[model samples]
Target: MSTPNPNPENRQINIIDPAFTLNPQPVYDEVLTRYRVAKTIGLNSPVISRYEDVIWALRHPEIFSSEMDMHVGLGTERPMIPQQLDPPLQTRYRKILDLQFSRARVMEIEPDVRRHANELIDQFVDAGECEFDRDFAIPLPCRAFLRMMGLPQEDLELFLELKNGIIRPPIANPYDIAAAKEYRAKTGKRIYAYFEALIDDREKSPRDDMMTYFTKVELDGKKLTRNEILDICFLFLLGGLDTVTATLGCSVFYLAENPEHRRRLAEDPSLVPAAVEELLRWQTPVTIVPRILKQDWELDGVQMKAGSMVSLLIGAANVDEQEFGAGEGKCVHFERERNRHIAFGAGPHRCLGSHLARMELRVGLEEWHRRIPSYSIKAGETPRVSPGIREVMYLPLVWEKGGAA
Candidate 1:
């Protein structure tokens, strides 16, 4: 996946760069091949790259704390529940959350996910050309989220506006940090107010939905506080809607360039699950996760301060030859056995929605291949990927009219 870098020591990687988001495997390769702990160019944070080292950091939350004051600008009034906390409080929250997002519960939503995929395809499958991100990548997950949260489908536009306001902030200048923060703070208030109303509505008339469950579910013999429920919903609103969309976009983008791999799935649909996992590892949409050190500790000969931020390069760790193998073309093998990639993180705080995410990715690819099986990137247009999540914000795709071969 990467040409060998003779001078990996001098390699300058900016995780927020379009180049990195477009193709991060080379940077991962270089980091794994040369340095155990590295640093990024633009962000200038210490990076932990090896698979073993990363797993250690993820597992030992006491040494590497997730609790921090980093997300105020992202519209989080408080730490978004569970994700931003460590055990045993985080563990208790997961006990309540796990049931809501279990594999069996997630499977209940599959039919709707499949139906939505086909409906999205129907809109553009006959046109022979479509902007994949706008047409399919964005809405599918948003609709699924609306269903899961028991929100009205017609509010998709407003939801998108709120999400975009917090994420990209809709500022005229991308570098205007002050304006972006101010805009997100305003959006944060809206998110809280909206969810607060939903919590109230659920209290008045409970339904068989996540919001209702949160309203009634007892934790340690008492129902959750309103702030706790609001915090949890806030996490779900941001995480549930964005992650699958980004992963789906990156996966389809991969298949577009690698027609051979795409043909494999089209010819045999059963490979979709494995293909999804492989893409999760290869693409690693949520590129880097940050942790603030709880105490002064040295890792892999790198000295660290107590409050310094450690950027765990799970993206690089996923491709590390130490774990995934070093044989030619084997590190990124789609069908590789014994793959324990941590694209979803590891240990106690592993993604709670992984089951739902897998189901969505699998159904999405299966349906897309079933209908638009032979699409490619539109000529004279390059995919535009965002910096943080590696989302293909502008992915123009084209195929022969009515083509399914």
Candidate 2:
């Protein structure tokens, strides 16, 4: 909202700094206040921090495209459907994905999601405390998503391991590119192999699930190939598995740290829905989305060359005063009248699993507060969040083992 620094100094932000990952708001505030666009010292990409610029780039994917040839590093053999593609082709795939993830269809999965939420709580509530991320945040979505896809729910642990292997490879050095790629490639193979068997099963007996839908759905009057379904499922493994978990982790952590906000939701259940949106805005789990420039583009006098990657700071934009607080930039309230935050992103590739995510978050929160209404971060233990998705991986929460518990 503040005028782009007319004579801005060279601002270099460490996009992946552990400290920044732990507490990124200060960095975001600094960027939003001083620079419309800055450069990431680690990734070396131009960081678009303003809400307007990020939204414009997202909407106009013709200029700022999502299609990139860097799948190997992302633990994928090929570009995943809809997500890694641009419009027209991307739009067609979305047509099919959108129907499968429509609100009505997501609503049908709600009862099971709610059941799983409460069931996860049942294990930890009696103990009066639990490591929230490891216990609840991860498994709930894993099982629910697997069930929704008609996959074997019993393989949730395997799926979690496989997903983590790709995202956060279990190695001593996080910065070892050779080790990281080797691990990701191995994990990618296993992921493909895992889905290949399931694809065969789904095809042998086409069922009433999303996996089957992918196998049968015709795009541009042609049925999707086996690889296409595998690609879609691969994207699902990344997007569906990680994003919702990140949202849940961040949402629960926020509630745990702020008692009044938690009390408001516990006392008045209706606020849970709005609270989900607010949390999504304030603590955008998927902090940065990568885009490649199809052609040269410039914003705020900073030139971005063609084919270079651009980092759209969704978290920074969501809290920008220009759009959020009428130029205040500190909008963290659940009762706000309007919140056009692109937390799920904007335009043709806006998250395909958003409906399911909202239902999961809303249900996850409703059932969580209903069971454990009074809780907080355990004393003397600092929670740790991840760099990319901003997931609070080690959130220890405690409460009295009675009343709602």
Candidate 3:
């Protein structure tokens, strides 16, 4: 459990460090095998990367509290509800949220999801080339979220900008911890302000949307406060826009490179569901999950003190050799059996929109391949990958015009 000098080489690694962002598997490979738990640079928290350890930590949220102060250090003014709350409170908010994103409810929009995916592909399928991220990956998910939230489609660009500002801002230097924190604070305030206006608007002119539901939704016989609603709105806005986009981009990038796999999925549409899980495990967009220690504890011999910050490395854990089998972690196998991936996370705080995410991912892949079956990474172009929230940016794809359709 405890290994003195786990990282004897002292190879500098931080979740946000460029080296870590560009390719994190190497770092994870080293740390996960060397020590189930270890510390890293740039991130003031200890890193837990082993599959079992990460699962243990997530399942036991009481000890490893999710009450992370994500308020940009500007205090309670911009609290991210449910995500930053614990137990009873977190449970209450999640109850209300569960109803809206329930599997049955999300399925009701499957037709629209399919329609939107085709609509976006319609723009570039005939051209024989397109930037997958911009033309397809990005817009499809955002449009679905807008349709679900009943938000104006025109505001997609604005909301996308705001989401990036908080999660992955256009930083001059991503490793600059101080600067990134400051930028997020400013962006978070803008998000808070934006939601406040929406909440106020719905209060006067109620509509049939999630925003209105939050305004009237009650917990323990009391309506959710303005702050609580803002927190929910804030969390939903980010989750709706980013998570699926990240997954779609990663999956498409893989498909572009692996035509064999693409052909199989396109030929056998039923395989798409199984393929989705493997892709999520392989290209986990969410890399770091942060939690604050409630009390001193020793996990697998690693001593962590109370109040310390511990990061459950989901991206690393998903590929852990111990869980996924030796050498298999690196291989993208669509027919992988017993593939228990924590891409959407685990335990009490598992992604509320997971149903919607799975639908969007499946529909996006199914519809695209149904339209354009054969494609590959454009010649001389390589996708740009990031570290912390592992992603494939600007995936340029090309195919023979009318050849595979």
Candidate 4:
């Protein structure tokens, strides 16, 4: 194991650029090199980019707090439900929510997921060209999440708008913070109120869905409070909507660009699972996970005082030559055997809805391959969106109509 140099040479690290939006390679490379030499250092904020340092930080939760409110500063005060809570208590909340995302539960939702994907494709397949993000990527996961939570499908648009605000705030403009704050508060309240009523309804008349189970769950010999249940529900809504949306958009974009990779999967239909992992590694939708230092520690050579903020750059780590081998780091191969990537994060904080997300992606890819496998990016018309916390948005593609016929 190579240790980061304590008195390493200073190197210029580029944290941001005006031109780049989707592919943030320069920013990531700079951070990775700097973190390798210095262990932990301050950038836009402090970053802990090396794979080992990040894994250590995630494992040592006591020393690296997951209480994001403290780390996120005044930006967000609402507790992040189970994510913001630590052990024992955190485990309890996670257990209550885990059942909803369990493999069996996800299997139950597969038919609905396929139905939703086909329904969206049916609308746009005839158009021969459509903005995938708007037409398919956004609605598929949004509707799946709604169905899983037993929420009204009519509120999908509202849920998406609010969820995006929470995860990807407009950090470029300081003025946007106030608007984001207002949106957070308003959305948080509305979501809480909505879930609270749902909880009440479930308690009065329980059903087989998640809300009923949440209402009846007890932690440490006491029923979960209304606020806590609402917070958990909000987390589910935000986590499911944005992360899955970005991932699906990125995957579709990859297929459009790499027609060979798309062709292989389209022909062999069985390759969808491996292709999903490859897309996750190549795109890495959830780029960074921030942790607060609870106690003094030394990592990758740099000394750190307690109370410092550190971020794990999953995007950079996924591409590290030391981990993934030469040419393997590139997105060319979709069937790599050892395709373990931290796209869903790791450890206790690992994405709880991973199974459901995978199911959604598999269904989307399978259905898409059947209907619209041969698509290309529109000429002179590039699809793009923000690459901040979430890395993708709009993806436009053109296909020949009746190709599947």
Candidate 5:
């Protein structure tokens, strides 16, 4: 367990670009090859890159605080619902929100999810060509989330805009950051207002939806505060909307490029579930999750001072050769068993929406395989990768008539 190198001079620069222009492979290789865990590039934030160390950091939340305000200099600190809070209180919040995403509950919503996917795909399946991101990936999750949250379906475009502004702030220009902040604030206000109305409505007329559940659930023997409910709703919207969109985009891109893998699942729909996990491991839509050091602690021999920010590179960790079988960890092999990936993260703060997200991916892949059985990227057109708070974006593909189905 060698200590992570901390000297700024020794640290590799731009390994984790704020702009996310480069593929993380080189950075991951450097970190894993040399230190297993090393100081981050550019910002010099401490980075835990290996699968095991990253899991350790996630599990020991007391030492690695998820509180957003501690690292205000990096970006705006939106209260991240249960994500930013630690246990006792975090547990309470999780309990209140977990029911909505429970396996049984998500199963109940599967028909609606499948219907939404079909409806979105129906629009472009016959077009012979379509931008997968805008046509299918973007709309599917946004619409599904709106339906689940009981939000107006018409607000999908606005939701996508606001979510992008907040998550992928333009770090290259100060002006962009300012504009993103403004957009985030504006959209957040509208979202909060809507959640407040929903909360009130649920209070007056209880229903079976998640909003109603939140409205009635007690935390620490008392009803959740308006701000708390608002924060939770914000988390739900952000979590539900962003991750699956990127993932669906990646899955579509992968299948388009790998015709054999696509055909395998198309011919046998039962493989969709296993294929979803492998795609998540290979694509890792959510690349990194940042946590602030709660107290002075020693990790892999390096001494980390309290309050220093450390990023758990979930993407890098998932691809660790030590954990997953080798020959570069990026390859997708759906039949591989014992495939435990950290795409959903780990420990207490591990994705609250993991079950629902998995369901969405499974169903989305099934519907995609059924509708668009064979598609390919256009010639001379390379996919544009957009890495931000997460990775994978704007995957464009075209198929011959009836090829997708």
Candidate 6:
């Protein structure tokens, strides 16, 4: 609740500070430079901010366990499947889950993804201006994944609200424990009920989509329980829908600000793929990932007690000068090479939907620029951006009607 230190050099930062949430890079840069590891305000959890330490902790899940319900007050009885399940049991679910998100599978859907991106663009192209988040970014991934999961597209709005309530609740202060818990508890129950009904339907008459697959897939020679299936659905609903929306919004907002970076990708379409990786590195959406300590551990000489939570600053680590050379002016290089960003994380819990995420970003950027190359942030409008998921809520973009710059 404390005001962010007005002076960047000597100021102490709370990760959940509203100002920090508005724009985190400056604070993260300052913190990582001054103190590689620091503690949160009220939570007091050690936040791992360096590239090497972040990856090291992610790799050693034995010590930094993911099983804990890190969102303490969310009322989750169990961790979401696969990502939260450690090694042995995790390995079992992963074996089947891996095939579902395989490169080949994602590639098979590429054309559909591309088509959907264009379809979205077509809706706002002639207007020459649009609110990028709600119209394009949110729906692009939501509609596509809903089809793949055999869920109704009509429910897109419903899911969007539910997802936001959990991650980006509409409260004066996101770090307000009581408000966040109350919002999450109500939203969580609705989400559970929605998926539970879907599960029941899939059970009676399994269809030809992911929902059916989840119902049929066996683990340890037993069908997944309804709650287990719901957990998987819960993860997919959040992962499948929001991450891409947030990433796409951030990508476009940056590209809008830096016309040269936007022009470079538009001129040479081949660079789109690399641009996706670089953008992801520069504007990592999922910022802090919390891991509970299995036992006493030490990171950068800071001893963490057992059962303590460590927040991994994925956004800060991606821009570490050691890994990626200092970004031009700002800390982003669209052409940076040897970029090993853990934006999706590392170890056994690395994002399963990464390939799909990459494809969506690439296609979304390519199609948007293909239609409107010389775009800029609508003048006089300040976009709303947040830190945790680093999203631009309303990206007002305006461009000339020409195809090329």
Best by TM-score: 2
Which numbered prediction scores highest in lDDT against the true structure? 2
Task: Order the numbered candidates by lDDT, best leading.
Answer: 2, 1, 3, 6, 5, 4
lDDT of 3 by residue, 1-405 (tens): 325544322433467666666567788787776766777676666788888989989988899998766565431365577888888778888888899999888898889989988888878888899998888888888889988887888988998888888777778996687887788778888888888898999999999988899898889899989888877778787667677888898888878778899899989999999999999998788987889999997765557889889888898899988889888987889889889999989999898899999999999999988888889988998688766566567788888987645
Model 2's number of clashes is 0
**Local accuracy of candidate 5 as per-residue lDDT tens digits, 33-96:** 6775566664577777889889988898888878757323222235667877888779877887
Candidate 3 stretches with Cα past 4 Å from truth are 1-12, 17-22, 73-76, 170-186
Clash pairs, model 4 backbone: none
Q: Determine which window of 10 residues in candidate 1 has minimal summed lDDT.
A: 1-10
lDDT (Cα, tens digit) per residue for candidate 2, span 222-315: 9999888889888899888778888999988888878889999999999998999999998898999999999997788777789999999988
Provide the TM-score for each candidate, comma-separated. 0.96, 0.97, 0.91, 0.90, 0.90, 0.90
Q: Which of the predicted structures, 1 or 2, would earn the higher lDDT when compared with the native?
A: 2
lDDT per residue (tens digit) for residues 162-270 in model 1: 8888888888998999999999999999999998999999999999998899999999999999999988988887888778889999999989999999999998998
Point out the higher-scoring one by TM-score: 2 or 5: 2
Give the C-alpha lDDT of model 4.
0.74
Worst 10 residues of 3 by lDDT: 1-10
Let me know the TM-score candidate 1 reaches against the reference structure: 0.96
lDDT of each: 0.85, 0.87, 0.82, 0.74, 0.76, 0.79
**lDDT score of model 3?**
0.82
- On TM-score, the stronger of 5 and 6 is 5
True-structure lDDT of candidate 2: 0.87
Lowest summed lDDT window (length 10), candidate 4: 11-20
